[model samples]
Every structure is written in C-alpha cells, then in structure tokens.
Target: MNNKTDFKTAQQFLVDNPDIEVIEVLLIDLNGVHRGKWIPRHKLQSVFEGDMRIALTGVTPDIWGRDVPSLCAKTGDGDGICVPTVRTLKRLPWLSRPTAQMYMHLTHQGEPWGYDPRVVLGQLQQRFAERGLIAVVAPELEFMLLSSERDAEGIPQVPQTRINGRSKVGGQLYGTDIMHEFADVLHEMREACDSMDLRLDTLVKELAPGQYELNQHHLGDALQAADNAQMLKRVIKGVAQKHGYVATFMPKPFAHVDGNGFHTHISVLDENGKNIFDDGTERGSQALRHAVAGLAATMSDLMLVFAPHRNSYRRFAAGTHTPIAPTWGYENRDVALRIPVGDPQARRIEHRVAGADANPYLVLSAILAGVLYGLDNKLEATEPASGGSHEQCRELAGDWLAATRDFEESTFVSEYLGAPFHEAMCAVKHFEQDEFNRTITPFEYDAYLITS
Candidate 1:
C-alpha cells in the first residue's frame, strides 16, 4: 500500500478523473508477466501509504504457473511488499469504465528486492553512474495481430484488413496500403498511447502478414525506457482485444513467417551530455568498439536472457531476420550488433539479439553489463562482419536447453545479476525444461505412432 505522503500522483490523478471506477496495480515478474490485483476507487486511498503484499513465488512462476520449489518457494512460500511507482499511473481508455493502472516494485526487509528484474537493472545503472556515464536506450517491438476467431483446429489466423475485410495474402514489408487498412485500430492505438504517456514513435508494416513493429522514443533513463516498452505492449494487447482482434508478442507465432523481435538501440552519454559513442567518425568512437566487443564476448553466455522460452528459440532459424552470430557492422542488418545509419550526434548500437518475448528489464541489463565490461577491460572486437556474420563468428546457443546450460555456467551472469538471481533463474528454467520434455507433442505422435 502506498502511504499518503508518497501518493501525491495517485491523489492528483483521482482528483483529475473522478469517474474512475477501479485501479489496477501491477508487478512484473521474471518472465515478463504482469501480476496484480484490481481495487475499487474507494479503496485506492488506503493502498497508497500501505504495503501491498504478494506471494514471492508469483514472480518466479513458470509459463504454466507451476511452482519451482527451488526458487524462493521453499522458504516458507512468503510474501513481498509491492510498492507502487506513481509516475506509471495511467488510464485505460479501452475499458468500458474508467480504469487506472500503475506499476509496482517488489521489496523485502525494506531494501530493493534482489530477485526483481527492475532492481537488477537499477544496480547496473548505478555502476554506470559511478563512471560518470548514462545509458540512453530505445526498443523496437514487433508483434502480430490475429483474428479472435479460431480455425477448426483452434489455430490462430491473421485478422482481415479493415479496408478490404479480407486476410492479407502476401508479404507487404513497408506497405503503406497495409497501414491504411488497419487505420481504425492503429488510430485508437495512437490515441491510447497519448493518454498513457507511452512515447510511441513509429509503426511499420513488417515482412509477414499481420506483423508490425512499434518504436519508442529514446530516453536517457534506461529503466523508464523499459517501462515504456512494457506499457506499450499492454496498451497494444488491450486495444487490440477491444477492436475484436488478438495481439501476440510471441517470437515465432508462425513457423513459416518472420518472427517478432525486440531490438534495443543504445547510446552512452558522458557527464557533459555528449554522446560517448560518437567521436566525429562514421566508424564510431573507441568506446563504441569496446561496447561491441563486450556484447560479442557475452553473446553465448547470455543467450537465455535474449531468448528465454522454448518457442523463442524457433525465431533464430537461418535465413530469418534473426541474428546467427555475435558480430557487429555499420548499417548492416545481417549482424547482431548494428550501427544504424544516422546522424553522428545520434550514433548508437542497435542490439538485435533479443526476441520480443524477452523481458525488457533483463535484456537491457545484460546489454549494459556487457558494455560496461568491455569498457573496463578495453576489449577489442574482430574485423567488422560484412555482408554476413555466420562464417566469421561464433553462434549463440542453438537450443533452449543449451542456452540455459550456458547461462547457468556463466561467471559473468553471476557477477552482474547477483548470485541469488542467477541460481533462481536457472532453477526456474530447469523446471520449465523438465516439464516441457515430459509433455508429448503432436509431431512426436505423427512420426512415432505410425513408424514405431
């Protein structure tokens, strides 16, 4: 519960919108799942100054919401205090009644929660601050919009275009026609974005049918940038549902089409407010090279952070836009680390490794950690990966199990994410892997039932 002194934003928001019927408090878990409770308007005032208790295991649950006994669950299955961040307060325009939502941060013993992803990122940010530097970041998130109706097999299908009221039949990358076709829903999305304070900048029609990308405005506060990404995802999903469509951020929603990606664009700034990655050259400054080297060195070890789930690994198939190797290049989309063609003052590294399904907090933390490591060690990168990176660079873990194993064995992960989070995350992933392995798939039935 928030206390009166700390609930200024909430109080003002209520005063500004007297008709609000409910307030939803949210806390994001390790898997990027938002968990919370809805309170009536009358009860909102009491929660502001009070601590809202939630089960600690709620933040560590697997995709199926099963308990991983090894992860904080065995410690009496306790509760953690969820404190709200007032700046995250926003109204849900899609809801029938006016409803407001705010994000929360978990804590224990009056200290920042060790297992919280936001806390981990904040810890890393402090490290940068000590070095008189700040990390500026923006995220490009891709997702697919499907019709709410399912086929006979209960499989999802792309929603029909608003203009033609028919399914899109072909790839239309950057097609203005596709944008116009979804104008009604997109217009609602834009309006909602404004109401929510999510700095959504651009929407592009992607290569696959029903696939699109949304880019957020860059901000020097990495955590706020991540918050924007998370909120934007919620806004898109909710608005789509209200428009009679299903929106998905799953990395590989369709096996035959392009997958969703969460590309993070990052630039470093010195205390003097100058872009550290820019030294008046197109090749970038020495700091930029160091950052790239750090990212490459940790690519394999941090694969789990970039692609967390079994479905996430499916997006990395060759010939896809997904990256196959830990390589960097300027104005090249074929490499994992791309220096986009932009103004010298805006020079930045675009990390294209993370899937849209990845946790924005963890993804940014891993990327920043690598950058810091490279700067500290003054590491050097290999020659730029031109045309393609596969032949010249080492690949990230190829499978989900392999990725988790690499993450479990990484000293760097332990160093940056803290030993407890490392252990808890590994335990959770191992549990999820075991559960997945035990389930029989349709492919298995098709192949083995007839032959064996």
Candidate 2:
C-alpha cells in the first residue's frame, strides 16, 4: 500500500481487467471532495508515468469547486504532476460502466505538494519515523441513508425500509431488526468494501432513524487508515445510490436527530513494537497522559480541521454524545479523548472531536501532530474527568469563523503543518465563510421577513 505507482503495474492492471474502459484518477481536495479526471483506459499508463498534469489549484478549491482567490493569485495557477497511489486502484462495482479508480496526489518537480492533505499526513508520518514511533489508527465513520427524493420544500426524507418499503422513522440504536430491514443495501456495501480491500469491521444502527456507523479495523499505517476512510465513504454513497437512496457523511444532516461523527482510535508503538502507552496497568503510562494533554491543549487550534463547515457546528450541542470541551477520561464516551477499557497491551486514545465530513487526511495529521507534540514535550495531562462533567474546561470554537481565526493565528499549526499549508487553509476557509455570510437562510426569512 505504498504511495508509489509504476507504469508496469498500470499496464498489468489494464491487461488483467481488459473490460475496464475508464480509469478515474481522483485527487482529494482540502475539503475532502473527490476531484479529478476520467481518463480512457489507454491513458492510465501516462498517469502512472507522471505525464498527467492538473492545476495545483485543484487541491485547494472551496467546497463549491471554485478557486480560492488568494491561492490562485499566489501560485499563478500552475500545473502539478499527478502520481497515483497504487493501492487504491480498484474496479467500480456500483457504476454501470466498467470503470476503475485510483487515488492520486499532486507533485511539482518530483517534490510533494504541501497543499495536498495526503502529503501533509505523509509528512507527519515521516516525523513519527524520525522519533522511531508508529501511530496505529482506526477510524469510525457515521452517516445517514435518506430517500433520494426530497420533500416538496426540498428537505431530505428518511429512506424507506427495504423489506416493507415503509418510511423509516425511529431511532434504533444497535437494533438488529433495523439492520435486517436494510440488509440488501448494507450487504452490497460490504461486498463493495471487500472488493476495494477496505478493512470494514462492524456496522451498527445509530441513534437516528436512518443513521448508521461503520468502524474500520485498526491499521498500523496512519496514512492508509485515512485512505480507507475516504474510500469507504465513496462505497457507502455509491452503494446507497444504486439502491435509490442518498448517503451523506454530512455531520448534522438532520437538526433534531444525532449528528455523524468521525471518531479515531489511536495508539503509538515504540521501535521495539511494544505499545508505548501501556505499562501493563489499567491506568496506562505517562506517555499516554502526555499525548492526552497535548491533544487537549491543541484541540481548539485544530477545530477547523474537526468542524470544517457552517453546518458542522450544528453537531456540537451539549449532551448529544458529542464532546464540547477538551476533556479526557477512562472509558468515558462523553469526553473529547477517551481511554478505552481494553487489554492494557492494546491501550489507545479515542479522539471524538472530528465530524464525519472532515477530511480524513487532515483529521489524522492534526491528531498525530498532537501526539508528537505531547511526546516531544513530555506534557502532563490534567486529572482524568469524572462523571462526564466538563464545566471547568474551555469549549472548542463554537462556529466556523472562530475556528478559522484560531487556525489562522496558531503558530503551532504553521510550525507543524508547514506555513504554506497554514496560509492556504486559512485563505480557503475565509473565502468559504465570506460566501456563507452573503447568503440569507430560509430561517432568516421566516424569523425576520415581516418583523422588521
């Protein structure tokens, strides 16, 4: 699963899958949206040979696919080479056309593009290598399956049960009966994941009517974990669409129901292959505490990476199984960082901040960076929170604007994720915020149309 790809591999793939007429070379943007070109099968060899080129701006677009004014002006909108990540090449099972897809990264003159989120994660992995540590990551992603048809007012509707075709309308947390109702779609999604070699672990009925969560088995390679998360999202959406439903990883798709979250379970291993966070006790080790402290300290600074959009803020309301403060506790689901009750040798920290909509690469990079910051500085964690009370701790940024400002001003982010990426991210977020500010929502009209 290395990032490198060669012409020989591409040729072999084309030879093996002769029916694959098209190859989708996808580049993940800052907003975690897939953007790229569909190349004829004959042209995929050129992509593997580094002959394929795309604008460097392709990886920095706003959520709407518009170029960020500051970024385009700074780079003169130059081109960068696209290098495929060999492991991601897989046939599209949900599409009618016999198509295959490969994930790619932008490079210039053989150097990794700093603005590429994958490259950022790679850089963080290199940093961990320098310290002789490996961060094992398992990500849990939550999403909703809705009817493709919207209401008359265009609001989303819960999908119908596959068995009876009745509108689904109740929270069935971990209910096997609900799971049976959507067995057809879920089974197909599982098959799709198998084809892509994604390590999907468990599927659970969530607290909302149409909401569900899928967990992935932990991977030693943090980069690949993020890759699997991204690919899994595509699988969920594609399989749902094939069944006449829409799948969304949007954090808070429905205001009243539970929001989707991307929770990451992380553990660090030393060169000797022993978990550094474990000391054969229930309390774990000092290193684990330091990691917790570092994450708590930097949680606010990286809120933009966790809650990236305006709607992303809607998921942060208190007492909704969402962590508002940078609090940590043993086996406490209500805290931002929870130390799971498991075998001491498998001890890990579960980061509960990020929404499913956040870029997996950025979420992972921010997380690993925090772990490294803790390890290097030997920071001490505050006392473990008891009984889920977090009133003593400060809350993370409540909105996108505040997060953008915090990210813009953070020296830690600039130093860790590179100054170029920090600047580019801030500029793109600012542009999006400006766009959001210019629009008046229907709620605004309903509240103030005649009052003023």
Candidate 3:
C-alpha cells in the first residue's frame, strides 16, 4: 500500500469520510519491520497537522529486533513522522475495531533519506527514465504454512493452510481441490490487494506442506513495483493475524526442506517501446547475452542484496525451483537465471537469487543496475552451469561472509551501487554477522554439553 492515492488528496478523502476512525498507521523501518503507534480517529487531525511522531528505534537500528545498542535511540530513537502517504490508507479487515491502514515511506528531517532502500530504487527508476527505458518486474513469492503450535520435539511445526477437515491423499499438479482448504485466506488476500491497487494474477499451493504462492502482476513502474512487493508482505501478515494465523516472509523459516523465495522476472523496454531482450538474430542478440553475463558475473557480489540472511542460503537447493548456481539457461529450471517458456514478446530474465526476506527496492537496484552494466561493458555469458545443488554447493558461495567479501570486491557492483552505499550496507551486515558468529546455537549446545 505504498501509494494508493496522492498525499493531499488522501488526507482530504479522510476528512470527507468523517466516520473513518484511523486506528493505526504502518511504517516500514530501515530493517523492513512494520512499526507505529496507535491513534484515535479524532487524532487523525494531529496526523494531518504533522504532530505524529513515532519512536526512533524502529528506523535507526536494532540487532535481531532488540535495541542492543542505544546509538539510534540516543538520537531521538530515530523518530520520524508516520506522515500520511494517504493512498496507503485502507480498512484493516482483521482488527478488533474499525482499523484503517496506511504505510509511510521514511523521511529524515523532512528530506527523503538517502540510504533508504525504497528511495534508493526511486533514484534508480529516475535514472532509467532518463535513458528512455522502463523497467517492469514481477515476483513469484513462495512461503510455508506452519502449524500455529510447537511439536513434541519442541520444534515449531507446519500444517497445510487448510486440511479440508478430512484425511487426504497426494495430488501434485494444479490440484484445484486443495484450493477449497484455503479459499477464505485467498479471498481476503484478493480484497486487500485490490484495495491497495496491486494487481494479483494467481494463487496456488506450492511443493512443501502448508506452502502456498502468489504471482504478482507485471508492474508498470519499477519503484512502485518494489514498494508493492514490500507492501504485500505487510498486508499478508496483517490479514493472517485476523484468522489467528501468522504469516512471515522470512527466507528460511524452516531448518530443512525448501525455503521461501521471491523469484523475480524482469524486462527492459527501450525508447521505441520495444522489448530489448527480443533477439531473432539466431546467434542471440549481443545485448541480451551481455545482460546475462553481467548478472552471472556480479551475482556473488550482489548476494547480500539478494540473499541477505544466514538462513537465506538454505533455500538454494537443486531439486527445488530456487537456484544454487549463478548461471542462465533458455527455458530451463536448473540454472539460476531461467528464460521461462513464454511468448517471444514476453522474453526476459528470471532472477532466482533473492530470498523472500530481501528488500525489494535494494534487490531491484542491484539487478537493474547490473543489467545496465551488462549493456555498458558489452560482456558475454559463458557456458551453461553444471547441474548440482544443496549437496555440492560448488555453484553457490558457502556463507554470508563469503558473499559479502565477493560483493565488496566486485567492480561492476561498486560502479553501480557506489562503494559508500555498498560499504555502509556491509558495515551493518557485518555487525549482525559478528553477533551471530559469536553466539552458540541451540544445536551446538544439545550436541556438545555432554556428548563431546
């Protein structure tokens, strides 16, 4: 719900809808967490007057959701206006009372924050527009459905989104029967998406138990599309709560089996409004090859922006749709970049590097910028990737540190995202990495306390 309507207009609409009691405002902080204070409907006046100030901790800094350091809190706790983006205003269907929803973009001292991911994409979109190109993208998102309770082994469990209240057998392909189990959830999701102006195309049950997917429509504008991806997660989580269920886009919520992903499809249209990827020249257009080469060449460097979390790496298994190797193939699922089977007019690269948790704006920034680098450098993609996956891991980097190191050393990456931005992101990621590295995991304790 990034931009439902314009700012001034949305405010005026709320004024007209006097009966609309604004109960909550949603804001995505630097870490992509939703945070804001509750306000009464009458206080909507204060929101419009710029008197609304949310706490700083949500925006400034935190380690795994904790205020481990007070750096941000010391500076007004990173407080900012949950300034009404107005168009984000909506009725939260699940709240106990009438709840209206609006998502706020971040601003510091009334100027768009430079390092903000959303703003970062916005800047890139303007750059693309200058070159007479439009970047349109769609993400196929997948997530697991987990049991709301813990298991006998003290591990969290997952159950199907719906069980049809009866014992069932297996049916893998387009099993429409299972749709009934989760029809209610889908209905709510459709309503929420429509109200937010995000076009929804399809919903299907995925491979893993309780896992389901949502295929987003092709986005018209790049920046808005990324914002829509971020907003959809917020909406899904909010709506799930109403049904006494929890929805999370965390990349690898489960330890084993397949993890969630936001596989992106991207296309670049030229000034003449032609799909730049179209190549009837037989040997493949030089530009398209270069784009693929640039992507494969920079994937290691862009991993943090693509697969950020320690857990995110787990999703890149060979058998599953997620890719373990940084390679491309025509209409092939085995490679990281798949040219999906479709009409020639719809031909584009499908980037499989991202996890569900990756920031959409940042991911898009890395990708579109990488593609531009391809065009600039006139690079060429090499031979197809060797097929191997979770077991071999030869194609994918080993750990987050390795990915970060690769990203820092990338010439293509530094040239696009800029070294300062890259380094700043590295700094933040390293902070988390160090903290995680030093801590002993539950698995280590259970295995070592007496057995060793």
Candidate 4:
C-alpha cells in the first residue's frame, strides 16, 4: 500500500473537510517530540506545492527544548524542507476548532535527515526489505489519567470519581467496572481514533488507580505502527484534556504504584506473505529463536532507548512487573522476551522492556535491528526462564547514566543506527543529564540545610 500523499490528495482532503480552518504539519524529532507549524486554511495548498521550510535544529532539541550547538543546528538554525506524509492526514475529532493534522519527514538537499525519528524507522524498515522480510509490530501503551487540578504540594492526583460517581481506587486490574468508570472518555478517544484511522485494539484497567492500557491493532508495516503509537499518544492527551483530565505516560508516576509500560509485539513475514516465525508446531520456528536471541543479546546495549528518562529506571524494582533481566520464555510475563501462546500462524515475540515514555521509533528500531543482527549472525538464545528471571540473570544498567554510557559506547548502535544519530542522541542525553545535575532538589536542600 504505497499511500504516499501528494498535493492532489491534500487538495482532496481539504475539499472533504471543508470546515477545517487550519492544518498542523508535525515532524517527530529524535527526542520523539512533535515539532511543526500551523498553516491557515487558505495557505494549506502551499504545503503540498513544495517542502515546508523549518529550522534544521527544530528536531534536535532536548526535553527542555535546548539545542545542541555541536550538531551545527545553530548555523543561523538553517532551514530544512519538510515534506508532508499523506497517510497521516486526518481530522482531530477531539479538538473544538476545525483543524487537521499530518505527519511529516524532514530532508536537507533531498536526503533524509538522520536525526528524524520517522526517518530512522524508515531506514530500519529498508534493511528488513533488503532481506526479503517485513516486520509486523504493535505497541501496547499504558498510561494514567489524573485530575487536572494538583494537590496543595502541586503533586498530581488521580480523579476521585469516574463519570459514574464511583470513587477511584487502586488495584483494579482487569475490572470491567473500572472501564465503565471512564466510558465517556474512552468512547470519545475511540471516536478520535476512528476518525484518524488509528487501529486501537483494546482498553483495559491497569493495576494503579486511574491507570489504563490501550493496545493498537497489529500493523504489518512496522513504521506505520510506530507512527500510530506516536499519534495515539497525542490523541489520548488531547482527548483527556478535553474531558477535564490530565493524561500522563510517565513510566513511574508514583513511588508506591506500578509504572506504565510500552510492551511491543512483533512477528516477521517473508516475501511470499507467509509467517516466518511459525513452523506449524508449539515451538516457534528457527527464525523466531534467532530473533529472540538477538533481542536478548542486545537488550543491555539498547536500554537507553527502552528506559530513556531518569525516572524510567524506577520501574525496574524487584516486585515490579517490569523485567529486571534479559530473558525469554513461552507466554511468560516475568521474562523480558515472551513468546505468547496463540494460534500458530499468529505467533510473535512480545518485547516487554520499553517504558511508555520512550520514543516509539527508537524502540522499534532497536528491536528490528536486534532481530536482523540475530538473523545475520544466527545467534542462539539461552534456556527459557521458568520463574522470575532475575536470579542469575544479566541485569540491565542500574541507572540512566549507565544506560546512556553503554549506548554511547556500543559499536552495534553506531553501526546499525548510523554514527550521526548515535552521536546526536548521546549528546542530547548527556546535555539533559548535565542540566538535571545543576538543579538542587528539595531533598538535597532539606537534607543539607539542617543536618550538614
């Protein structure tokens, strides 16, 4: 389905949604940030006439929106042409104003910008294509819905009542009543998803109070899956705000509760449209094993993408559902890589390491790259872990600093992701770390003021 949108398609979209007053052309950056411009309805045609001009450094900002001067993003912050991706053209049903949005990719001198997350995923997909394979992917995103208002101390609090007037409580995992509690919000979210062509599969109540999980329908095109994941986050946040709730995808929102996880399920298919992971038996095919082996072997090196933020590591505690070891098993939730029990044709590897906050493009890239690596080298996986995999298990880096350091030093990352991307990502992370270190936390002030 080569659904690349051109100016004629954009014109048709404008004609169909004649009420739309504006268009938002968004480009996903290396940090997974949506950077773009808004064009008035009258000028929307110009967007398709040629590439939209934007500062090349628009995609290189840290979380604080600080630019990395080392990338030369500040040589007058020169303009890069942004080409609109037609497949992403859709109406945002949640917005009150008549507005439309489209995803975009940036290019300089007609070559894809290496730092663009969308470009990164597209590049990785090409590698799969070269091997006569296609990866099917789905990302199950978990998040929390909180009251828009904060507490006296300015901490976020879960809403006390659902639309049904029931008090919000914890440990409501898989409870139907909990789903009913947020029925209106979820229904509206579904409407938004349908309007935007986002294939949302399920919504479930999570373990924490006001926590929820939404699984996307598996996409045969892994790149589109990442694009949908990114768009879904935007939709959820937008819809939640309209419903007077604050939606958060932060990995660890509370110290005592379970954290949000972005678990990905993947399966590869051959040129003839046959499942390469299925050998028509209980045990998956050799290709599946090789994919698992690659994932397990490279898990440590890719921790930075899975757990990107400082608080991301907080989800990896002993009792948390998050995996602390690089292990695999059949239908085992305790292991990092689980081969879910399902129909033989539907067999796939569920990668459970990434947090809800990680960039979908980077996460998918790391996973696909690992699978290719395993297949290229015919890597072998260790025995499946029966119980908790932590015992005698290889632990992921204990903290963000260690994880980022490992990523920066990894030859595999440099080779597969390309050195320019690797260096820029590492530089941005290091800048963030340095910026964070300069901040004096309340705990530091209290501990030092009187005792020291």
Q: Judged by lDDT, which candidate is best?
A: 2
User: What C-alpha lDDT do the candidate models reach, one value each?
Assistant: 0.86, 0.90, 0.69, 0.86
What C-alpha lDDT, on a 0 to 100 scale, does residue 277 get in candidate 4?
A: 92
TM-score of 3: 0.85
Under the 3 Å rule for N, CA and C atoms, how many clashes does model 4 have?
0
- Among the numbered candidates, top TM-score falls to 2
lDDT of 2 by residue, 1-452 (tens): 22243666777877889999988899999999999999899887677667888999899999999999889999899999987887788888889989999999999878999999999999999999998999999999999998899999888988666533564456678888878878899999999999889988999989887899999999999989998999999999999999999999999988887899999999999999999999999999999999999999999999999999999999987667788889999999889999999799999999999999999999999999999889899999999987664353447898888988889889999888878789888888999989988999898999999997
Q: Lowest lDDT 10-mer window, candidate 3?
A: 164-173
Cand. 4 Cα-lDDT:
0.86
Model 1, 1-452: lDDT tens digits are 43665577688888999999889988878898888899887777656665578877667888777778887546467887887778888898988988998888878778777677888888899999999999999999999988999898778898766544564556588988878877888889889999888888898988888998999999999888888888899889999999999999999987888899999999999999999999988888999999999999988889999999999999987777688789889998878999997788899999999999999999999999999999999999888877764454347888899999899999999897777678778988998999988999888999999999
Candidates' TM-scores? 0.95, 0.96, 0.85, 0.96
Each prediction's Cα RMSD?
A: 1.9, 2.2, 3.9, 2.3
Question: How good is model 2 by TM-score?
Answer: 0.96
- Whole-model lDDT, model 1: 0.86
lDDT of 4 at 450: 93
lDDT of 1 at 322: 82
Kindly report which residue pairs in candidate 3 clash with one another.
5-87, 56-77, 56-78, 56-79, 145-210, 146-158, 147-158, 301-407
Cα lDDT tens digits for candidate 4, 1-452 = 12335767877988899999988888887768888889887776666766478877777789878787776643467878877778788888888899988888878888887777788888999999999999999999999998999988788988766543544446578888867778899899988898899998998888888889999998989888998999999999999999999999999988888899999999999999888999998788999999999998888889999998898999887767689888899988888999999799999999999999999999999999999999999998888877874563547897999999889889999788777678778878888999889999888988999999
The TM-score of predicted model 1 comes to 0.95
